[model samples]
Target: MTYQESHFFIWIAAAYLLGSVPTGLLLGKLYGIDVRRQGSGNIGATNLYRTVGRKVGVMTLVGDCLKGIAPVLLARQFGLSGEQIAWIGLAAFCGHVFSIFLKFKGGKGVATALGVFLALSPLAVLVALILFVLLMLKWRYVSLGSVCAAAVMPLAVALLSGGRTLTLVTFLIGLIVIVRHLENIRRLLAGTENKFKA
Candidate 1:
């Protein structure tokens, strides 16, 4: 392959590897908890918070978000094209959703996707965040908020940034997020989903 092609693949691989880090699982281990075996059986921040502690959950959130941000920033620093960077962001989100380290199992890509869009288009992220917050405040269901925010992201990106590649990637990431929350959606519909506290 040519140098540019090779460089791009390397970055894609790196971003995926970074995204697959399983922040909640590692943090849970540090505290002698295996988050995957705990509440909701999820390695995402919400499960971490409910199963572990608030601090660990928050840490996981930041770490997963960074996994999304770092790769995009590095791609930009390396002078990658916007389309290439969009792909890299998607790679990062995919990693979190299908982590190699976790035998291809991973968490919902909410926080990580947030990081990606925050890097690609802060305005879109802002709009999504407002939606998330409003839903959270009104319904107290984290899953509902996440699903709704993710559902809104593609349109937000298209309208605010006008980057077709970025919008498509965001749409895919948002779709994945919604898919990963299928169980939660069922629970929400059944009125049995856990509500976030404080």
Candidate 2:
């Protein structure tokens, strides 16, 4: 293919690599515990909080968010268009959801999804953040907050981002987050889901 095609492939590869960093796993290993084997058996921030402590959980949260933001920023630096940038953002989200090193078992993709949305549509992020805070305040449940945030993400993006490609990308991202949280929803309905502790 042409040079542009090759460059696009390279950028996507880079984005995937960024997404595959496994921040939770790395932090868990540092603390001498396999995060996947502990607590809820999830390598996400919630599990980190239950298995380890708030410090490590916050670290995982920041790292996961950065993985999403970094690659999209790099793609922009490469001078990719809005449409072309969507691919890289999607790759980053996919990497977080299906990390190669995690045996394909990954987090709920909420944090990573936020990273991409933050890069592509800042206003959408602000709107989702407000909704997330309000929902979590009322329910005191992270999973419910995450589910509501994901559900609102698409509408937020559609309203904040007028382009079809960006809107579609945001919709898919939100869908993925919601689908990943299916178990959480079930637990919420059953009143068995764990809540965030101070």
TM-score of 2: 0.97
In order of appearance, the predictions have TM-scores of 0.98, 0.97
What RMSD does each model have against the real structure?
Answer: 0.7, 1.0
lDDT of 2: 0.87
User: Across residues 1-198, which tens digit of lDDT does each residue of candidate 2 receive?
Assistant: 999999889888888878887899899999899988898788888899888999999889989998888888888887898887987898888888889877776888888888898999999899999989998888789988888888888888888787888888888888889899888899999999887777
Lowest lDDT 10-mer window, candidate 1?
162-171
lDDT of 1 at 92: 97
Clash numbers, per candidate: 0, 0
- Predicted structure 2: clash tally: 0
